[model samples]
Target chain A: MNGEAPFVPDERDRALMLATQEGLPLAVRPYHALAERLGWAPEEVFARLARLHAVGVIRRIAAAPNHYALGYVANGMSVWDVDDERVDELGQWLAAQGEVSHCYRRPRALPLWRYNLFAMFHARERAEVERAVAVAAVRLAACFPGAVRAHEVLFSSRILKKTGVRLDF
Target chain B: MRERRPATLDDLDRQLLWALQDDLPLCERPFAVLATGLGVSEEEVLQRLRRYLAEGIVTRFGPFFQVERMGGAFCLAAMAVPEERFDEVTVAVGAFPQVAHNYRREHALNMWFVLAATRPEGIVETARAIENAVSLPVWLFPKEREYFVRLRLRP
Candidate 1:
């Protein structure tokens, strides 16, 4: 645990985050409908969400989809080792790729964990993901010789869960 | 030093969440569909969702879109925030509108956050902002391999 921050959500705040995370009700007056059920006034429910957003508790209220249903059948986690100085530059370049959904750098395990830069390539199949990785590897290796050392491709075996914040109140 | 209380779930709530876990209807009147399926009024369906949300049993209930489908740039990044500055660094990193969710996990590089940008530049700009705000080297750990694991809590 990082330096523990005291962030005990009040009952109302907790409810708001839960609702935002779970799913906003499909109603014309969604806030009002939700408020009516929670035994609170609609104004209060709306106000609380606004407040949470202001305080950064609830990041953004949006809808996502089940990707597999949409034909994106394959996902690959790709890792790379790039020059420390150019990691940001290369990361930005890789992030630009439409097929690459996720890109970031993680602390590498000394000696063993030499790779730092990571990009997640997703496509309709393993071959598509591999092709994307191949192109990216070539583009990245051209800049930093011996900088891009190793890469690993881990395919998703199963999806345990995809829901946001665990509500344990 | 302290007592740990176990969380409990009732059958109906479990049923409601289980119904929503995977196949949330996508339509103009999704509640109508849910109501018909559950043999309850649309208001009753809404009420159960409200109760679940209030109880903190479900964090979010809505469409889980594939980011790639929507033409967005997203990545999960982690930084080795020094123990002393962890709080400050997290706050700084969380300030970015582009950041979706951040968590503190048990690892040397503790602070982790997800960045979703409408444009590619937004990702780098966010990293720069975080680095400048925290006054520490913000390591961008993008996803190398994506294991799509659908996690569902069994009641």
Candidate 2:
């Protein structure tokens, strides 16, 4: 996904990220061009890309459209508290959810922040976001017998320096 | 932060945008690949891309990486600021180089920010520094597992 789990990119992964991060070339065989630049076989580069994409290391080889332009003006980083033991299944479900663009099972900072499950919900407006949050909350509550403890939809009133996270090694 | 503006799209622009998202083609002269698919010229494809970049319609025209794999740490953090100190604290938090994103949200934890740091420890260090600077408790929520993270907006 976006800010995926913590892990060090191998030399090869670093090479790929660095070489292609500046936008792939506008050539017939862009990967072939990438191969030529990296001094590796075009086929090898293609295979590596396929592998990385499969493993979620490379989310997609696509254009990240401006969400605001796409009508999702108001987006909320919806965080929830659920029994940690029961989060895996719920997180997986949320990941597959059409609206939950990004889903993660983060560690809980108890007493202060008990939200172990974070799902990003986007919509054209705040009310839509609240409705989506309510839907997801209901589903999560079903999975967990205990009170959700806290469900907060942090609707960003302002945004600063938003961009895709990169591995710039 | 960016303002919400209407991004007018022509049929050609929409076609080109779709092509760019669908795997930038894995062939020689990839733009030509897209051009051929859209029944346009390779030069036209290149021109459109340049314009899109210049116009800020396309923020990035490349592969998006899994940041953590590249030896970086990203986290969602927040602080509850007094109404009087909201702007002051927002400026203070925005000053950190690692603060990739800071937002004003409506909730108890009103001030929210995303931190992308070179090292895992850097996230904690920055959080602590911000907490001390604003004299408020900073709650750090580091991602333990990523279930899904794809933002596909079909034009």
- Fnat value of model 2: 0.67
The TM-score obtained by model 2 is 0.75
lDDT measured at residue A13 in model 1 versus the true structure, 0 to 100 = 74
Interface RMSD of 1: 12.7
Could you say which candidate leads in lDDT? Answer: 2
The reply for model 2, stretches above 4 Å from the true place, is: A1-61, A139-147, A166-169, B81-97, B128-137
Model 1 lDDT tens row, B1-155: 00112235466555555566655432345666767876778787777676655544444565332233223456666677788876666567655766766655445656656776644566778788788787776566454434222333334
Tell me the tens digit of each residue's lDDT in model 2 across A1-169: 3445555556886687778866776555678878999999888788777777766566577676666665567888888787667778778877776777888888776666678888888877889888988887787678666746677887876665455554423
**Which 10-residue window of candidate 2 chain B scores lowest in summed lDDT?**
B64-73
Interface RMSD of 2: 3.8
